[model samples]
Target chain A: MGYHHIHRYRIAFVDCDPAQIVHFSNYFRWFDTASREFFTACGVPSWRDTERGSGLIGTPLVDAQASFRNPATYGEDIEIESWVDRWSGKSFVMRHVARRGDTVLAEGREVRVFAVRDSVDPPVIRAVAVPAGIRAMCGD
Target chain B: MGYHHIHRYRIAFVDCDPAQIVHFSNYFRWFDTASREFFTACGVPSWRDTERGSGLIGTPLVDAQASFRNPATYGEDIEIESWVDRWSGKSFVMRHVARRGDTVLAEGREVRVFAVRDSVDPPVIRAVAVPAGIRAMCGD
Candidate 1:
């Protein structure tokens, strides 16, 4: 019941492994899917359709990691609860929790930054401040 | 090296996120990376070039879940060694280990089955026996 952020999802058949449990990799993809949808629902343009493909801004993951608490399998429906807790100039924190009913499947956090499109190398990642509009919506 | 039926990979910076730790989701990507290399080395055709445009012989997960015993971070390398120990017709065992030079970051095993593409209400993930070639190589 928190306005912070929330995303719901179902485990697809392709999401599992030979062990009949969700592969660890799929969780990251799910996290990205839910988080992106949450942002889109909040009025942020789709990263894929941003700036008419001008690519002026993109949120590429400079770093990512996760810890597995339990297993998820095909046919399981789960919910992801998310929040934007702290923000620095260029970076912000995204926390996520995966659950089935009341059972906690996994907990994770991601630190991301705003990157500008560059012609060469990768976009420079900096520690700049969060945009004012985003801050107002995310509620610092 | 003996056809020991296992490959080990050490997690590294390139494999982690800004949390200065491993994201639970990155594990599946790495698992795919390691498994692909291992199978190709064992003589399985490239996943894409197969005549089936990726044949019906698909390694799909039936279940997957993990537990974190330790944290892995930037510049640290951990081993991800995998093996196929159990095979009964269409299903097999793939175990992966994330470790430092000697310390284990995480250890997990997945249960997988080879299923055909089914177009139905809910795709029936029927288990087929492990192909002879794969069994010979992995059932060491």
Candidate 2:
């Protein structure tokens, strides 16, 4: 039901490191952008609706890690695969796989908590349950 | 005298969003990459010199919020300013400011901590003091 998600992007010139390789650091950035895009594609915006756009998530990261696989270069078209590997009452896990022409560049994951809701002016903070409605759309 | 610390970067094309605007999350990626570069420029290549490197920051975002002032477009030159804002014996803070042609795109920060230090297998990690040696060099 469109539960598992995978996103793809072309590695542009600016994505490369000084060594002319896609900097190891960039994989995370790519992972991040792709993940955000994944949600955006699903009609989910950022953590806040400060301007009052009303997004579904307002979470904080609790853990993250990335492992490098192969070197990716500038101007290479790569694919970033992202999915909700785990989603529970309080937290969710996202795994990202970045690759270039069958060559894997990096693999990573971020664990987060839907730890708050409402605004900070008066700060109506609360532990939010991962909405049951979104479950059928998640990966794991 | 070489102290590895966080530094910011100039946002490149790959750092933008579908709106062709500099997406809020791109700031985090640039900040992360820049911080890594700042450490490398200080001559402490973390991935290469694990013993002297700061090791993985394991930066699970405690909290991250940004204020977008102006829109930054693709290929537009942007400078991301970052610094160690606050440091405790247990943790340290890094602030990042992104600007394009005198206009501010977004301002945010990351809270990170070194988890250990000097290990043969698991890698050395610790919240070492913000080395005073390179403070002046990063400001520009």
lDDT of 1 at A116: 43
**Alpha-carbon RMSD, each predicted model:** 10.3, 10.7
The TM-scores of chain A alone, one per candidate, are: 0.83, 0.75
lDDT of 2: 0.56
Q: What C-alpha lDDT, on a 0 to 100 scale, does residue A36 get in candidate 2? A: 65
Question: Which candidate has the top score in DockQ?
Answer: 1
TM-score of each: 0.52, 0.49
lDDT of 2 by residue, B51-113 (tens): 335443333233333444555556566777666676555555667777775776666655654
Docking class of 2: incorrect
The CAPRI category of model 1 is incorrect
lDDT of 2 at B1: 28
Give the Å error, residue A56, model 2.
3.6
The DockQ value obtained for model 2 is: 0.06
Per-model DockQ against the true two-chain complex:
0.10, 0.06
